[model samples]
Target: MARLTILLVVLVAAMATAFAPVPLSRTVSTTALNGQTRVEVKIGEGEPIESALRRFKREVNKSGHLMDLRHKRYFENSQDRKKRKIVQARIRKRLERMNARRMRQRRS
Candidate 1:
């Protein structure tokens, strides 16, 4: 009878521990330099790592930057080289702004 009570207590404790979820960061980002893509993801704070990664992958895929790269190179010719530099500069500027915003939030 004592052994049965102990077993029941152990089972309940194990079950409680097993169902507990680890608290995780809600913000995740992935930057692909080759593709010139930076994705910012938010999953409402406390989502699992798996969910964050999945959402990151989905955002990257949906960004269309990969397909844009396939159809177009950042620089293909002399004329395009000039334009590519301009476009690249613009993209870099945008990413810098985003990074700054993230930093500001982190500080707070």
Candidate 2:
């Protein structure tokens, strides 16, 4: 009886997963100067195209492919790349400091 019950439970779980509804994913491929990258977004059944497009844009931004493509569009010398990185780091640090100051003021 115990084995039969366990088998029935396992069978039910398998069937449930097998019949589960999976969202359809659409892939958008972008070709960069270096190579190609793909971003995928899932669209649920009956979902509107506008929302799906928004989701796709979010995914692409999160993946950094668009920014990467822009960066790769131009060839930068090593010295220029290093200078850009330094400037970015400085800006990032300044923003972090500003945020910290804001947090301190809020606590007070």
Candidate 3:
């Protein structure tokens, strides 16, 4: 009698699950970039809708799509770009030297 009851319960549970509708959201895709595998994820079932967009944005950032868009947003001559980069590099080096000096002083 206990066995029969357990079997009936399992059968009913299976039927309920089979008939229950499952909501699925699509936000998973695989892409190949320069022979490298890239997996992107988005929001899915039981996840907030806003999180899906955030995931997409993060994926774009990982793929450097956001950087590309920003670069293409303005028209700049190659020479100007090079000059800008040189100035930025100079500033970065100066900052690095200053940081190193500060660190050495602290250690001493």
Best by TM-score: 2
For model 1, residues 1-108, the per-residue Cα lDDT tens digits are 999999999889878945666434545556678746788886665567698788888877888777677747554777876886799899999999999999999999
In angstroms, how far off is 67's CA in candidate 1? 2.0
Top lDDT hit: 2
Query: Can you tell me which runs of candidate 3 are displaced by over 4 Å?
Result: 1-68
Please provide, for model 2 over 58-95, each residue's C-alpha lDDT reduced to its tens digit, 9 standing for 90 to 100: 87897787787787799988998899899989999999
Across 24-107, the per-residue lDDT of candidate 3 in tens digits comes to 565455587896656667556688878887777667677865565677689989998899789989999999999999999999
Error of 2 at 29 (Å): 13
Off by over 4 Å in 2: 1-35
Clashes of 1: 0
List the pairs of residues colliding in candidate 3: none
Worst 10 residues of 3 by lDDT: 21-30
- The Cα error of candidate 3 at residue 50, in Å, is 12
Give the better candidate number (2 or 3) by lDDT.
Answer: 2
RMSD of every candidate to native, in Å, equals 13.2, 7.4, 13.5
What does the lDDT come to for candidate 1?
A: 0.77
Error of 1 at 80 (Å): 17
